[model samples]
Target: MSQKKTVYIGPFIQCKTLTDLDICPNGMIGVDEGGRIAFVLRDERGRKIPEGDGWEDAKIVRIQDHGFFFPGFIDTHIHAPQYPNAGIFGKSTLLDWLNTYTFPLESSFADLATASRIYNRVVARTLSHGTTTACYYATVHVPATNLLADICQTRGQRAFVGRVCMHEMSPEYYRDESVETALRDSKACIEHVRKIDPEFDLVTPIITPRFALSCNTESLAALGKLHRELDLPAQTHISENPRECDLVRDLFPESKSYADVYESAGLLTPKMILAHAIHLTEEETALIRARDAKISHCPASNTALTSGRAKVRKMLNAGLNLGLGTDVSGGYTSSILAEAREAVFVSRHVAMDEGDEAKLSVEEALYLATRGGAKVVGLEDRIGGFEVGKMWDAQMIGLEAVGPETTELDQSAGPVEVFGKETWDDLVAKWVYTGDDRSTTAVWVGGRLVHAKEGFRL
Candidate 1:
């Protein structure tokens, strides 16, 4: 078991802050053992009102005058094996880029030693970028996938890792064993790591079908059955590119649409997360909402590959569970704030051109990054908000650097006064528009300080 620790942080802000509406002026979340949270509310006498263990008199360890702490961002679609290609850009479409850059780069994860070195960098960078949890797709290499899973578990970040299962029609070098072998290996991986307590609990084995074109009908059906039998979450790409959609149509002629391919195979369940629902017909949208599945919007990747904008506003109106993703490598950066900004910008652009009856709001986007994302990963009840009794998975962004006061002063005074105007919405707006990894000064997962900038280690 990991060591027990208690820490306090303050002078922060959060928009739509979840602590309370009555007296709680800001979102102040507390974390205790097992990554649990205890939101503090003081009585009239100023005595601490407790929610869980170690609530009273917890020692203060760090203080940030201009920090805004909120629930850490959750990435629902990213490739751990593709970490080496984090900044690969300038592609016109998905299939073209996959062939030109993505596949060639993914094939490298077959090396376990190589995976070890890369996984560390991926986690370090992701933590630095304020992502406390991620849903990662590793290569079919079981050992390499295992290495990646182990790193996430030991390092105390929530991760849903799929052992990149693919049985037919992929590049020879990157493809995995037969369907039966893939199933058995995936099940074994699930049971293997689930025994390691918190780290293992943080790690879940998701059944990943590379895509419709990559997996044969038999393979998709088998994995779908495995997900139902094991009660596990499943993920895959869907309707991401027009060419890929056409390929899916050619591959599965009987299906009316691309979404039907998975629906027919019994994979589109509430437990499933479909990445990039950029090309959904009304029927597909109905089915998606009916099944309660989620859409993982990768705005950066969509624009980077010219796949067109996802109907985010329509998806939300249809009552679909939706979240944002960097789709890094495909996306140039791992910042969810960047994803949020692009999500709004692209949605408005699409609405203007197509004149779709949908609008995206800043509050809606922030909700997607937090609660909507947690739902996509099947952790909505336990990990999304700064409420009492939720997991204390939070991050602190220093708003001091990007406030109005800095602009008011000349470059001589060091500009420390602007931080006071950094309200929750102001902080988040600045974060979405101007922030990067440097803005993230501290990260805490399950009540433990996992990442901090300069001279502090947990």
Candidate 2:
């Protein structure tokens, strides 16, 4: 396939701000040969195409009335190795779930063949669901973790692949031997990703400490220091469950609080991505905002594991950067759309306890999936939404129509039903409430057709 300059004309929808969505019913976006948006033409009734040097030969793709262009999803935190174990957590919370399900499955990556099989499926599945960029947690095995980076590069999904680091408090068979060995293996994986994608354009390495309970003081400090030395993004869990919080308190008695454990180790930097801040104190929230660190709200995982609902409305009001995460296995679903739905539900639950101001609207949840996620992964300038100079990471969503005459073939489009009398807002609301991966007819990353449904072609 030729990576030529192309023009996409269609009804496009994207979050213009945290509370508002920019729905361009008729728009055109020009993508250059390098896959960046070169020009954008907003709603202009029957306007003629402007002829210029490169615009003269641009291929044009027009979206049908039933479809619209949307920014691809970004999963800020997910365990790629635990994909197979998704939905298997039975009546277990964070700590017990790790021992019963997570550890045993992650330890199986010692076999290179097994790692390749699982990693391949994970990348393909996420892309199929329109996850253009993902922050992945690979197992501690260096070779397996490196294999994940290689697979993402080959498959053309933008990703941050991290080799998990845990030098203490983990199962004896799966844990890293020592602080030196953990650092060495982590460096090896980082170097491997750098070699494969030298500029770190598509795939980058992230420092992952697992969590406070998984690592000792020495390992946490060493990883934090390495994070600064390499200037890489870091991700870890914090304040997910009451038991996990109690364990961190017991483990780091010298620290004032759970957040202080990471703060004292120098891990609370702007590039840090702390997942599941469900039980953060006012002091911790202030500290996180001061450091400019981001949060990944894994709503589905939290509910499934019986973790407390994160005060998302509070976090947004505090000027904290936040995004959605699947937290697979614990989350039970890899779809960010599902996470967006869960986010809305979780916010409603918060509202029931703390009043109406705590509720999150659909616009806010979708924002967390795209723009917010881009910021969390440190790629805000590159892949969030449709704008000149941004990469063309987008999905084509098609909804089924239910009118006087409806065919079975039309119903195959998905669960969302449009009845011609609906406005653009109604259509989008229907999508949010009832849509699934089946509604995603086509997906693109960097102007490349990464996934397409059977009847859809670009």
Candidate 3:
């Protein structure tokens, strides 16, 4: 349980809806010992709010000048073990990139030492980037995957850890030996997560079939069976590349389309999170929406690998719940803010081809980062925004203000520059377009201080 009863005071920002941001110029929020928000109040005069049942010793954390508290990012899909190979996929698409850079690096996770080194850095790195919650795909090794669960639990970041299952089409050295071994090892990893977080309060287990081509028909069916029996959340890759989609046709001829392969295996459900649906047909789209499965758009990874642009606006219009994912090494960067920027850029490109309706405004992209992400992870009521009962999973964003306090040598304040004339929306747009990790000064998960950069204080 969290021991901190913290009172945070300052400006706050959140998605009021799909097209607008809820910006409170002066606000205060009280977090109780259990990490749930005890209350949220606002006043023009910045007056103090009433203290709750707890007698008056709550610690106070205030946002700095020109800063605001925004909901922490949720990365709905990422490969934890592939973090080492980030930005190394040079001139290769998904298939060849997997063969050359991804598999070889992921295979090294068989050594617990490598898993420890990389997992530690990846967790810290993502936390620094203001990712308070992540859905991670660890390597096939049970011990290594379990270590990842332990790291997230100990670090206080909300996570869903999955053991990657690729029974065939993968290299011999890294692939699961058989369908039985795949199920067994995946179960072992799930049990490990249970042991670490009994109620899955901070970390849970997800059944991850690497992709359709990597797993045979029997393995996918068996894994789906296990999913139903355990009632667990599932994740997998979908139609990411044109050639990969065509290959799925030849491999699973009986299935109607790429989405049908998982449907036939009973893996398409509300609890499933399918990443990179850049090439889904209308039938496949309707099927996924009917099933209520979520989508994690990875624009950076899609563009980095020269994958086709994902029609995010089209998906939203279909009434599908959508979220953003860094996709880590596959997409290159681990920062979700950068991924949000990529989403806007990719949407503009789509608008160029289609029409202006395809362009996603800054508000829409940020909504996908926070609120839409919460819906995708099935935690809409818990962590998406500031409310009377939501958990305090948030980040403090600071932009340098130009004034008498500014000096020529103060370059450490980060990439965003603000004059006295910009509105709140303009400031947010600047951060979305140009800001990086340096602007994410502090991060919190469930009222606990998970990450705080240098010079940040409570």
All candidates' TM-scores? 0.90, 0.98, 0.98
Q: What's model 2's lDDT at 82?
A: 98
Candidate 2 structure quality by residue, lDDT tens digits, 1-458 = 24988888889999999989999989988888888988888974687667886687888877865979999999999999999998999999899999999999999999999999999999999998889999999999999999999999889899999999986777999999999999999999999998999999889999999999889888899999999999999999999999999989898999988889999999999999999999999999999999999999999999999998999999999999999999997999999999999999999999999999999999999999999999998999998899899999999898877767765555455888887899888888789888888888888889888888886655
Q: How accurate is candidate 1 locally (lDDT)?
A: 0.76
lDDT tens per residue, model 3, 1-458: 85768888888999989999999988888888988998888753547657557627888888887889999999999999999888988999989999999999999998999999999999999999999999999989999999999999999999999999997778989899999999999999999888878899999999999999999899999999998899999999999999899999999999999999999999999999999999999999999999999999999999999989999999999988999999989888999999999999999999999999999999999999999999998889998899889999999999888886766857567889888899999999999999999999899999889999898878
Query: Which regions in candidate 2 have their CA more than 4 angstroms from the true location?
Result: 407-411
lDDT of prediction 2:
0.92
Residues 262-336 of candidate 1: C-alpha lDDT, one tens digit per residue = 988889999999999999999999999999998999998889888888988778778898888888778877778
When sorted by lDDT, best at the front, the candidate numbers are 3, 2, 1
lDDT of each: 0.76, 0.92, 0.92
Worst 10 residues of 1 by lDDT: 17-26
Q: Name the 10 consecutive residues with the lowest summed lDDT in model 3.
A: 43-52
